[model samples]
Target: MGFLQQKNSADDSIVARIATLVLRLILVVAIPLIAFAVLYAGFIFLRDGNAPKWVITAVAIIWGVGGVAALFWIFNWIVELFSDTWRARLQPFVFVGPALAILAWYLAIPVGRTFYISLFDRDGPGTGQFIGLANYATVFTDRLMREAFRNNIFLWIIFAVPLTVGFGLLVAVLADRSRFERTAKALIFLPMAISFVGAGVIWNFIYVVRPPDTEQIGLLNAIIVNLGGTPRFWPAHTAIAPWNNLFLVIIVAWLQSGYAMVLFSAAIKGVPVEILEAARVDGASEIEVFFKIMIPTILGTIITVTTTVVIFTLKIFDVVWVMTGGQFGTGVIATQFYRQSFIARNAGLGAAIAIVLLIAVIPVMIYNLRQFREQEAF
Candidate 1:
């Protein structure tokens, strides 16, 4: 009788464990489907725009917020259902899966579609008949495309990378030693708060030019006229047309300098003070200490900042679009892509330009990743 009782108790425990596992599995599967269905129904009602206002609000609150919470809860419950070792292995996936799914849907799918669209004729509809490398060939061989590439290179190399990095470093170093460090940094970094289009509009007034006989309304032209100089269409002067790209570059640089300054300032602060003191004790000048010690120590940050700016410059559109509309020799890869795809209705050409821009960015991104890995290892 004692043996039989012990066997019955063990059997009961096993059955309970199995029942719990089944219940957890059911919940994990069913909850997400139910929550998504509710969320979809809410979205449809919202889209139809015929529901009572209060009903719409209630549906949004319940479906959107509650659905997200339920999905997260389901994921957690799944991890909890596993044994300790299994739970440890599965927990990371449970947490990370949703983000991965989102990236695949939004990023990966679009990139694939862009590539697929690039292999067709510009005039053809709906992923036109694949013409292999023709679009790419035209992108490289076309005159306007070549000029756009040149301008993009100029922006990346001359203005975006070097000038922004240099200005940022200069401001950071100066601000660090200033009596009103916070105020100075805040003033300089203020430009970063403005959007590219807004900045473009503000600078447009600065660069604006009217008839030579008329009053100069643009701040820059007004200053020139006050200094007894003739007003000129600064963006369209034949002598300066090629370098007008530099004007757009300057606008981007102004906006981006603040970003670089923040990063560089942080990196400079991270340098060991003892090392600088040692260098100074050895009779090194401030400039020498800065060039030899501070710079080398923050080289990684400089590269990262420069590469990030390069990528931004490569895809620059807003400033050019708003200011010159890609006219006056200010076209960059991004604006060209926009013009080709939407304005000119050349989907294939646009996709090719986009791909080229993507290709240019990949190397810089790889370098950044390597830098991150090395930092982590250190």
Candidate 2:
């Protein structure tokens, strides 16, 4: 009789646990489905212009925030339903799943679509015919595209990466012990707060050119006129092949240097004071300590900052587009992509250029990831 009673108690406990799990599972499944259905209906009402303004607004806020919270709670509850080992395995997935799903929906799908479009000749939205590598060939072979590619390379290698990193390091070293360090850094970083378009507009005034004999409104030309020199069209003068690109690059450098400065400053501060004092004891000059000790210690940061700036430079379009409109040999890969896709209405070529840009960026991204992993290992 005692053995039978113990067995009956165990069986009842198992049944109750199973029932509890079933209830949780039902809530997890049902709540999201119902909330999403209501959300979809609300959106339909909004699209059809049938709902009152208050109804639409209320539904949007409640469903958007409340629905997301409810879904998160459901996932958390589901994770808790498992045993310790299972929960440990499943918890990470539950948290990371939504973000992975979002990336797939927004990033992966669009990249796939762009790749598909790149394989075909697209007339507006319609894919006209399959052209295997013709678009890519045009990108490589065409003179304008080649120039744009060269210009992007020049910007990345010569101007953007070096100047930004170099000036940032220089400024960081100079300002590190200065009395007005914060103010100087803030003023240098102020340009970064401005939008690229806004920066372009500001620089446009700086670079503005009027015909000779006209009152030189531009800062550069006004100074030149005052100095008794000609007010030349700076951006349009193709006589300076590729040199004109430098003017556009200056705007990007001015904006990005502050970003590099902040990073480099942090890395510089992180260098051990003990090590610096030891170097000084060994009679190392300040410049020698900086070059030999400080730089070697922060080599990873330099590379990281350089690669980051290089990636931005490769996709530089706004400055080129806003200031020069990609004319007069200032064309870059991004502006060319815009011109091909929207301006020239050649979607296939534009997609190819975008793919190329993606390819160029991938190596730098991989290097950066490796640097991160190496840092984690340390």
TM-score winner: 1
Please, what are the lDDT tens digits per residue for candidate 1 over residues 193-292?
9998999889988988888788889998999999998887566554776786777778888998999999999998999999999999999999999999
Query: Each prediction's Cα RMSD?
Result: 7.2, 7.2
TM-scores of the candidates in the order shown: 0.80, 0.79
How far off is residue 232 in model 2, in Å? 3.1
Please, what is the whole-model Cα lDDT of each candidate in the order they appear? Answer: 0.81, 0.82
lDDT of 2: 0.82
The alpha-carbon lDDT assigned to residue 307 of candidate 1 equals: 75
In Å, residue 128's CA in model 2 sits off its true spot by 1.8
Question: Global lDDT for candidate 1?
Answer: 0.81
